[model samples]
Target: MGVIRLPSQSRLLCFAFHIIFILFQQTTAERELKFVVVVFRHGDRTPVVNFPTDLHKESEWPQGFGQLTKTGMQQLYELGQYMRKRYSNFLNSTYKRQEFYIQSTDYDRTIMSAQSCLSGLFPPTSSQTWNPELPWQPIPVHIVTKSSDRRLHFPLHDCPRFDELQNETQTSSEFQNRIQPYKDFLQTMAVNTGLELNNLRTLDNFQLWNTYDTLYCEGIHNYTLPVWATKDVMDKMEKLAELSLLSLFGLYETEEKSRLQGGVLMNTILKSIKQAVNSSRERKMEVYSAHDTTIGALQIALNIFNGKLPPYAACQFFELYQESSGRYSIEMHYRNDTSKDPYLLTLPGCTSSCPLEKFAELVSPMIAENWSKECGKKDKKKDIFIGFDVAVGLLFIFDLVLLYLLYHYGRCRRRNNYQDL
Candidate 1:
């Protein structure tokens, strides 16, 4: 070592070589991010449905109810630009047909959000530019009509079993206990909002939330809220809303509900992940623009939901990676708050970087073999009746056979007696 120290140039070269070797090892050990699935709520919008008495009526909103506002457009646009920067190391500088996909819930707010987001992510460049003045190019946002879209939407309608489950949930001890304290407050809501809650359905926690949302949005947008609408009331409404959503998706028989609703989406996602891996597909990303319920439902299905509403433009990511050992792994991240990077979430039974095979196996139970069938397209009552009828028919056939055998024995005994006489 003392002899080597005599040559400064040689020592410097040796140090650089050691540093390069370490860097090379680290690079080779790093896993490669192969694909990603990004799902997000639509940005802020006019209330979905508002009370009749509210000052910010349907006419007050530019594109009517449930439409995206300028603020919403800006939110998605910024998010798109952020994504472009975030994935610059992975994604190409310009848009490619097979690199990514965008889908929405056939709603103006969500569809527009996707378009606005794409504008920022893939601004037209070089040959891609049609007009010199416009930086945007068309990106197709796919959708299935709402009624047929249980996979992306939530509180999935037309599911009789889910409806039955919800009814059961309301009667659950947990629901009764949680709602007992809020009964008076909700009655006050019924009075102040001028909405008549005559039945159990009308007395829903979700309804109270909508009423609060309307007034709150109005107040924020310069329209005066009702004098009765106070911060305390809003907070209470928000909690009730969260509870309503929870009660719907869980709080009783969580797994069954997940199989009926959230499982559908999760199954689709897992399929895409597997296909990308096995078929060596070029699909690098799949971006889904959906409602808050969609995000919540998916989280619930994965058993990773944090028991709160996912805020506006809240996003969840499922990323796939191939390790140096040639094995694949899945990782999940959630970005609900703007102030911080996405939090890495671990699957209940598996590590955050769970193997692809293990991830699929762990989640297989949640995936419904038939979503519609599980949701009660096949009648349970009919099946019971059919079984009952079959049992009765079998019993009748056995009795008939017994009666015939007894008659034959009697006839044989009479013939023997006559012959003896």
Candidate 2:
């Protein structure tokens, strides 16, 4: 009312300030994440085999095929230490029993890896030292079995759907094309090994994949691989292993299928994080001990397949942080090789730091069902038989009545015939 008008620039500045203030307040009001879900590949192990006819096949390794090695235990222990250090801020000064959770596939190696990692993660404090002699405390590691298992663990045996997927994968155009050169290479190797190339496919067990994993793990642990196993050779083997994993679960053609493997896991992780953010529970770390196949499958499902496969002891981490302004953000860390710094992954639609809601939305399409509502329409023509037992009983009664009538009619006809005679 003072006939004086504010400058347009000043008015715009005031509006900007208001928006910034509101955003800042909103950011400050948001909560920090306390929950975490970790998914990891198992640690190192011995080569699954030497060669088909080689005397050392399956006997060279002390623990036999696909079992975890000492080196694998060490690798997981180191990973546990890394997790402890990285999440120190988020976790309590002492390990709060309730705040942590671990899940693994029900393989000896995976279960053992999870146990070993826990050993490194929460070493016994002085107070918890045992018997004034040894410093050991039992920590629980949860596992999901192939049957009734939601975690999608490996050596995923006995799944009909998974088997179908694998068959489709082997016959797919992409797989056939990719393996054509490898098929020739196998033929050459067959000549060298004196084993038939055709037999190689048929004779190979799941151990083929395990052999590749063990060798890669050993190489990482300073156990030099044979000259025959060059970086290129290992790379090819890793790809093959990944292909096997895709065969297990990544067979669907739609984006939803993509999301199911990738998005479902991601969603599970986010939900855990959200729960952590809201709850006062103590556990800040979640560990998932699994196989390289799990990593490959999840990556493929998420559409984030890095060129190389995730080797044994390879780890992927999702870190959540609260900024000064109070907004929450996320960072992804990946460690494939022991010598390198953890690689950072910037999720699509997510920044080096991403919002929780955005992260959920990104994977929602993958996890959400894609069936049409119209397709779910009920068939009115179909009888809704309540209590199948009762329906069966009624049918039995109707059958008895018909039988009784037939028997009486026959008797009556017989009596009439007797009278006529």
Candidate 3:
């Protein structure tokens, strides 16, 4: 056969096409989503608790404090619809217990938020329809009582080391420096908000956060702010609230604090990811209905916190993808605003799409193998035995000393009697 020489332009075009083909393949390979885990805060609602001096009362809300309002339900429902649209191809048209799971913190708002979201996520089809009047089907939203739910709760009160860490965070130079300039302003807030200065600064209860929340909620609902809560004052209070939130899980020995607070939840997520990767089951989604603190703790642990309180219905997504090359990677996205798309959250020390193995390694330190032990909790039974042993030894030493004293007194008496005789 006669050899045909291609024109120079044709040769360049062929090389360009080859490069484009390779790039397209790589892009396609990376886009195969395998599984997703969503952690979302409960939708907008009445404040969980009121401040001492507040204009709004529980009776003012449609439901009492901390309950989901109609608006809150609609927010979650829209979130569900968004999710359904986003993952249309990945999930079944109808809800399958084997493929999808949802969990919520044990609270009226969260449980109801989960339910409301499910209503939009899996509206009944003709086959699933029990009643023609209602398009919603009851889907289970699993929950453990707040006392027992360690996975979704943040700033666990049972962890002693975490408590100690908070104490240290307060004393740390970084925290002190951060709050130093705000000292006079905090005192001013204390006077205006009817809270003790010490209480406002304390990180345990996040009193500053509560103050900000009440004001923020009232403003959201069109209630007039307290005269003291001017725009500038609210702005300052907001900054302190953000600082208070950050101080709960960081600002001193962040890794150790995360191990106790956020790490627990992260460990659960990592385990779920691994199971999805290894298992043959078709489980594709896990949804967590929780609080701002829950999202904050998790983000802090991952070193990706945006330094602001997560708004109502804010969501963090951990999506697992199996590339065409057979390797899995994780991509994280955060949706804090309904008006815009979720922000891509890149894990520190890794790219936005990090290899599964590397992501695990980076987060391994925060996961607690023994949560109780790491919390510096001693075994109660062991402590009791140790106390008993110490008490018995001390009693035996006391008995010996008493016996020696008695014997010595007896000898002295005998010698005196002999001299008298």
Candidate 4:
């Protein structure tokens, strides 16, 4: 037993290593991601709708029209893997039903994309698999039939008020200003492409979007476009398509329009975030596999859009955290480009890590107290009821006036009679 002591330099080295280890442990033990809500457009797929002149008809696609392509599946698979790496600390490494959830629009492409994405996100391992040969596991993707769906899908249909809003938007000074410069080009496109266009103003949002999508899909698949689809025409169509997107709930009373459309989804997302914070083990993450419109609507609702269509598989992530100060906050990120890390998105009125309550307050105007009422689905009934009440009030006032006139006439007659007497 020798009284051996380490050299002074060695003692200092040991002390430094101990301190570094403690700091690393503390950093891990202290910081935690409490909740996550990730919403993403479905991966690349066949165009949802196409023009009559298009060479790629509905039958030309693998599953006919609007089906997910193999390329689309791969894209979502890659996206899921990216999510796994990005949230390795927050989410469990293994597939755990209690830790995660997923949903998608009620479309073949979206539903399949959800499955493909989940395959990459939670590859089956050990007892989680039913068959050793298959690396996939069945994960439920919640969705309502298109007819009943309201919250997850964007540019919701059957909302006549939203349609009226669009009518006004197309007539706005800003809308005219943006589209005025493209008047000649739009006419040229209609003439050349045989796309029936009565006038520049008649280029409705869906029509513009449809043209752009056809050209875009054709270009990507290396299909030969007609001579009419020149670069200039395509460029203008792209601009018009962008404008069409803005026309959707972004122009004129943007907040109120959002409350009736994207805000429904936002509320659902926030609800999940709040729930996750309250119970950590119950749910760790929520994923929505939808369309480009879904992402666009959400971006505008969050007031963070960058003025372009979100590309295929684009995603918006809502990450929740509990700070050491005992307060909860939200962090948002957009992942449109796979080459780089997702960019952090800050609410225009708040910091990147906005407090949860503050985020709710700032976004409250966009969330509808009653979605159907906001969409004016019951406007006719409401109008009739109001009209009836107003009519009743007017009748009562008219009766009062008639009675007063009668009383005045009787008083004058009685006074005259007395005077004559």
Candidate 5:
């Protein structure tokens, strides 16, 4: 065969193309995405509870209090679609149980949110379609009772140490100073909303967040705000609500508080990352359908919180990548605003693509080795209380038996006397 000669320009073009191809391959090999863990808040919903004096009632909502609204389902469905687009290349078109897992808090809103998200993420493929008319497939969303779900639920009510720390945080000079500006506003809110100022300030369950959240939800749905819930008042309420949330996870001894709250979820995520790195057939992604507090608690634990309530359908991503050097790195991203790209979050002491070891080390202090132990819970006391109750019951039984025997003996003696007479 005769060798064909090319012009100088043509030779140069070929050389450039060859180099580009080689570089693309090298780049692809250098950064391979291995696994992803996404934690997202439930979407918009009716207010959890109506204020005592508010015109809006729970009955007005299509679903009663705290259940997911149609709008909320749409928000999550859109979020799931976004996830599908974002991970199209990474995830299979068909739902594969071994390749993906999803869990949600055991609330009507969260469970429904997960289902909605899944419907968007994995519409039934032709082969998997059971109902041709309906474009959805059933994917189990694992859940535990809210009381027992320590991983996803935050501000754990059972953690006495957490409660103590929160109380201490409330009393700190910093907290007092922060709330000083909101005192008048809080009092005004108390008068208008029929909520006690003291409880609104101190109780996590009834914090100012509830009021702000109720108003926020109403405003979104175009309900006319009461005269007292003016623009300025709403703004102040938001600030106070944010402050209240921060106080729960931060404001004082942030690291210690996180260990008992958000750290539990962080621990689970870290374990999953480790498993993905070590296992051969690892799941591609794990989804957690939770609440705003869940995201807030996690970000606080990681020390990357943005100091605002996570908006409805907001999501946080933990992505694990293997570098060319045979080491894994983690990248965190927060997607709160739909208009903007997700914010890149760096571990305080490490770079955005933090090394696995470095990431683990930085987060270790926040991760509790034993949640109950760290929460200052003592099983011995429970055992002792149980023992005392058992002992008291046994003594009562013994007394009853003695009384019955005495009555029987006295009745027999009387009968014998009557017979002898």
Candidate 6:
């Protein structure tokens, strides 16, 4: 070493290099993440409804209301194949029974759709055969029953706040503007079906809305709809249904419906991701098969409604990756068109893929408060409805009182007339 101490500049340069090296190493560690979560609508099925005058009704379909059609099966199978191809590298060479998990709403269509997906995703290969004679082994698809249903299931309860919101929305200037063009469409439907639009307006508050939902559900269940329902008509109906879902849960002022429904699903997914991250599990795909309403509500809650309505078999995906700098990024993908690559979603002040934590934080307010607690209370209330039967008993007493009053009034009038005579 030179008798002169190492220059201060050289020591400073060394310190700076060390810091840069540490940052580089940290960055390198973050970029190696691979995790994915997906929530998807069930494949096509029979319509939700069939108007009284419509030629195509529930009888047209072999499986009654809300059943999956053969076409739906084909659609899901194709989707499964697509997933297999897309994630071949991420998944095992052969489908590992334990590597992936699937859950669906406890409906026949959704259950079948999940099964169909599994069929296409992990077709029985020659190598997987424990016995040549029996090539297939049952892959479990978990479902929450209607009685014990959770996030991905049927019979979503009515939220009074959401109901109030819907009423407000019906009267809103925006809704009025949106429905103006559809008025002509409604009139045409009314004319063809012999349903008086004025009668509908007076008698049924949501006549048109109900009509569309019925058609939409019936279509998904494999029933043929009326000829009047062209692609454009069905498209419009889908939009209306989506609006209904948004009104149910996504509306800001109403009871936080999104939190109860989609918000719960999001929380579950996040919890799963966190678990995976902590456990360092290489397997990172989470799949949920649910109703169109689920997807619609989630999309609305996220404020990511693409103009086109999400059809049966629609899928929303969230991919999480850690960057080299130890930062996590999230990417949102939507598969509205099976043929095309999923469209990327962009969040304000963030890329389509933002940090997982940030994504949760953004949606936290929308999550319904005490959701699990409320759900528990609901179960208890449902039991009371059965045990007490107060609603039914009250109706019975009211009917009796009305009949008594009517009879007494008639007798009094007759006596008065007799006295006058």
TM-scores, all models, native as reference: 0.83, 0.73, 0.88, 0.83, 0.86, 0.71
Error of 3 at 214 (Å): 0.8
Tell me the number of clashing residue pairs for each predicted model.
0, 6, 0, 0, 0, 25
Best by TM-score: 3
Q: Give lDDT: candidate 1, residue 282.
A: 77
| lDDT tens digits by residue: candidate 2, 54-118 | 43456556788778988789999988888778777676645567777788877889899998888
What lDDT does each candidate get?
0.84, 0.67, 0.90, 0.83, 0.90, 0.71
lDDT of model number 5: 0.90
**lDDT for each residue of candidate 4 in 307-382, tens digit (9 for 90 to 100):** 8898888989999888766788999999999898899989979999999999988998888887777677876788
Query: Could you tell which candidate, 2 or 3, scores higher by lDDT?
Result: 3
TM-score-best of 2 and 3: 3
How many residue-pair clashes does candidate 4 contain?
Answer: 0
Mind giving the per-residue lDDT tens digits that candidate 5 earns over 1-421?
9999999999999999999999989978779889999999999898988888787988887777888888989999999999999889889988999899999989999999999999999999879999999999999999999878888987787888988888898889979899887777778888899888787766356557887888888899888779888889989888888887788898899999999999989999999999999988859999999988899899988989989999999999999999988899999999998888889999899999999999999999999889898888879889899999999999999999999999999999999999999
lDDT of 5 at 8: 95
Clashes of 3: 0
lDDT of 6 by residue, 235-295 (tens): 7766655555555454444326565566766667777877776785656677888877677
TM-score of 4: 0.83
Segments of candidate 1 deviating more than 4 angstroms: 1-29, 198-205, 379-421
lDDT of 4 at 39: 88
Q: With candidate 1 superimposed using the best TM-score fit, by how many Å does residue 158's alpha carbon deviate from the native? A: 1.9
lDDT score for residue 350 of model 4: 90
Evaluate residue 19 in candidate 5 and report its C-alpha lDDT on the 0 to 100 scale: 100
